[model samples]
Target: MSSLPLTRVDFDAAATRISGKVRRTPTLEAVACKSDPAPGARLLLKLENLQPTGSFKVRGATNTVMSLSDEEKARGLITASGGNHGLGVAFGASMSGCPAVIYLPESTPSSKAAKLQEWGAEVIVHGAVWDDANEAALARAEAEGLTYIHPFADPRVVAGQGTIALEMLEDNPEIDTLVVAIGGGGLIAGVATAAKLRNPDIRIIGVEPIGAPTHHAARAAGHLVTLEKIETAAGTLAPRTSAELNFGLISAHVDELVLVSDPEMKTAAEWLWTEAGVAAELSGAAALAAIRSGGAAVEAGSCVGVIVCGAGTDGIG
Candidate 1:
């Protein structure tokens, strides 16, 4: 809600405000960063999967909800999420003593909807896809005069998510590349902006499920594009479309876009759990999957940062 373009300065400030409010999170250094084209590459995992909400969405939702004025907070909040975002918003709103209404597609798993409801959010099941649910949520927000908490399109949300890059780079100054999962491009765009601001030389790579390649399609067309249908097991990353503003941010800051199959992501998630003891969701493991599939190569002795973005068990193993 601040402006069209989110700045690194604002991101840092949000990080400071949410410092004690959120986990500083831990970083896992991969023993073997590369074995092929990027032999000897050093890699570290930013374990956002360990956040209080079991996902990085809390960072954005917390920041946005806390920034709301008392009047706005009293008005209640409404939003649409694939899964993780809804939980984050619900938790944040509850913390702020603000009621929340979450609109989710009927396709969303009952387990996820139950989690949101547990946080005191009134869950509404409507539509068949993320976009359709989003439209309905928007309508409810206007009709009820509730505050609309956008999942990713808002500058506040982007800045909040960008704080992850700041925290990671602050601890590992040698990082040369960042690989992140992309949904509506919120996490990737924010991370790219913050990481690039700190080190313009750092390469920002985005990974999306091959079944839901919104960012990939948008990048190809140089604009936001919507998918008629998405059929990925990675529910959190199955946004039917990419936000134009987020697409622009990613296009300018991200260096490359790669995709991984659902099966590949599932394998990556299982591998991470076994090898790193990290509980990663399907979409959360996608960045690592892309790298494993030879999507991007890190230079020898260079440090690369990978975001383990979520831990929800909705659509992933």
Candidate 2:
């Protein structure tokens, strides 16, 4: 364990390092950005769902994979993902012109596997959970001399994820609060780090699936705690463990954590589609779920930014 190298400078470097490589992502101001319209609370959406890979995962994956040396890239890349991050790694490997091998748990849906494969990755199904698959992916990386990109554990990846906050604050200097969904914690970790560094008073509220509650449990215990089982259908946001790096960042920078149920997320997703025609996955809608449910305090006319982290047809279809 190396000490986490996350800082404002690192985040700025990642922003500049992956500028045109990844979309800057647009910010949309709309009342519909909320789960339900609030009388005076304004909602702005950071539309990362519009990214090339349809998720914010690409930022970290691109920063990690592209930062690799030519020889490292030539050695190939390997990782484990349930969905979004796998697509991100595949996209990163493709950009690097390096072969990518993504390991998925047997429980992952065929549609997700197909999506990764579509990105030119060699998809391998192994074990019964993401941790099991991750172990296998690690072993393969060691045995085959492939570079392994940890979804949330790596500092570079975390720093890359923070770039979203940099862009958001730049676009809306008055954004007083940031609402983000956490899976493995990379996105929230990065965003919180950047946002807090930029403005220490900027509130960072992290949303997690009620069933998962990875960070909530960790914060309650004052250390990392792995869940015995996951009970959420939002695979992208159901990681049982939040890596030490992410835990530390969230602890230091995040103002609060909100838990949203799968049903709430689905309702929020449906609301997004109906109100703004934005197709958001359940995980992506978790932030709005917290917002409109009064999960956090929304003072009148406060400018809050919610990240639509990914795109999916889960709610509409």
Candidate 3:
């Protein structure tokens, strides 16, 4: 990590490396509705939900898993996720016939655990938040010599996530402002790093749930900080603390962070479903929530990109 600078994240290499291993998910323009919040703003949706695991985390997990040595794969893969990354790691390991153990928080939806199980990964419902599950996962990895993949901290994972930036920018170079949701900060970290490096003039806006403003608080304190408890229904976005790697990249590359409420996300999700038929999870609709709720002060008439990052029936339900 010390050797790698923010400018040299190598998103292109990650794109080519993970080429056929993952889908080059398509992007589409969000046609305006009569009730549009930001009228005249050109909104483009990078539908990462179309990915095999129904989240962008697969890009990072597949890149990391494919980079592992055969001997390391034999030792098995271990990681903790609120939900999405677990599915990613499980799917990635399955391609190699490697065993994987996924540690998920109690907050994770049962549907996610069932999906992970479908990939042949052992699912352990651990503590209440991502940090608690992560602690247990790290302990088990250390105890059994398993290869642990850090969701946000690893350079490989960050680089993989950066590939989304490459694809989106290439697909539409006019995109001036990119709005992304923040969880442990991996997605935004990678997106900001790649987008800023690729086009220094591009603005990056990060969104988080108001209930779990981990990176927002970290940015406020100008250093890492942990929360007392989690409260957001966007479980994937409720990590109490942000990783140092993600914090550094986000602090360096992201322009500003906005916060949205759970209700706002639900509303945005409902809007997406009604308007575009995008059945996104609460965390996945966070970027749209920020824009729709005017939390992100995006300039009107400017082209903007938002990633609908995960899939679920929650909003529709």
Candidate 4:
């Protein structure tokens, strides 16, 4: 499928494709804790952190890798990522029995690199940031004639990520809003499309780190724009620019955009650990941060769904 406008049907088909290949991560009512909700507010957390790779990136990576032709698979898989996506590729390749090479920024956490190696990936540490590593991966893919899996820009990846929405709506049809963290916008794009298709009135709120507000910047400019620099601890959410297709999807389906500070995310992560016993990374905690920090306002008693998308960090404490 092209990066055309996705519908609920696409998400449904993706759910079918990824069934059993990925975990059907759970959704639970937010536990009462330090990050307690506003009076009458109800919070539902989608725990994608439980995925085998400790992140939602596996859903898309597995779908993309499994969809490859036998010949393409033989050529091997190659991709670039900050941390979680690389781990997703490594895990997906292991499942598919394909040789894989993962390019990562030098700044990537040691724990993530160790995980990639544990999954048997040829880990190449290059560049100082994700964009730099991404450029290297692209050139290497062309030079080596390898199949490249984009972290978030490809349609297949987006469709795979959309499966989360299908499961969410299935488990809780009454959800009135979905709060999701945005990086390259793949997850939010796919989710917004599916959630809106399921219920046209369902609000899709996209959250980004204030330091890496690619989606917010793009929205403000009315087009895709690159940031001069990024400085967020949420490495997974630090893309220089949003993809064009993702921008289109966001413009068409996402209802609002909010930005949260790095410290807010840390507090949210700590709250998840202390209150809910969930080990969330900074990126994973962004949606909840948006809510707790009042960056994304919700009416009291509204059924709010927040995606805790990853847990690949060393520790939340």
The sequence of per-residue lDDT tens digits that candidate 3 reaches over residues 138-229 is 99999999999988888788888988999999999999999999999889888888888789999999999999999999999999999998
By lDDT, the candidates rank as 3, 4, 2, 1
Model with the higher lDDT, candidate 1 or 4: 4
- Report the alpha-carbon TM-score of model 2 versus the true structure: 0.95
- Tens digits of per-residue lDDT for model 1 on 77-100? 999988778888988888888899
Against the reference, the lDDT scores of all candidates come to 0.84, 0.87, 0.90, 0.88
Off by over 4 Å in 4: 1-3, 312-315
**How many steric clashes between backbone atoms does each model show?**
0, 1, 0, 1
- Residue-level lDDT tens digits of model 2 in 127-148: 7768888989999999999989
lDDT of 4 by residue, 169-279 (tens): 899998998999999888998888878778889999999999999999999989899999998878889989878789998899898999999999998888888878889
Query: Which whole-number lDDT from 0 to 100 does residue 42 have in model 4?
Result: 84
Residue pairs in candidate 4 whose N, alpha carbon or C atoms collide under 3 angstroms? 40-301
If scored against the real structure, what TM-score would every candidate get?
0.94, 0.95, 0.97, 0.97
**Strongest candidate by lDDT:** 3
Deviation (Å) of 299 in candidate 4: 0.6
Error of 2 at 247 (Å): 0.8
Q: Which segments of model 1 are wrong by more than 4 Å?
A: 1-4, 32-39, 313-317
Task: Please give the ranking of all candidate structures by TM-score, highest first, separated by commas.
Answer: 3, 4, 2, 1
Model 3: worst 10 consecutive residues (lDDT sum):
1-10
Where model 3 places Cα greater than 4 Å from the true spot, the runs are: 1-9
Which residue pairs come into collision in candidate 3?
none
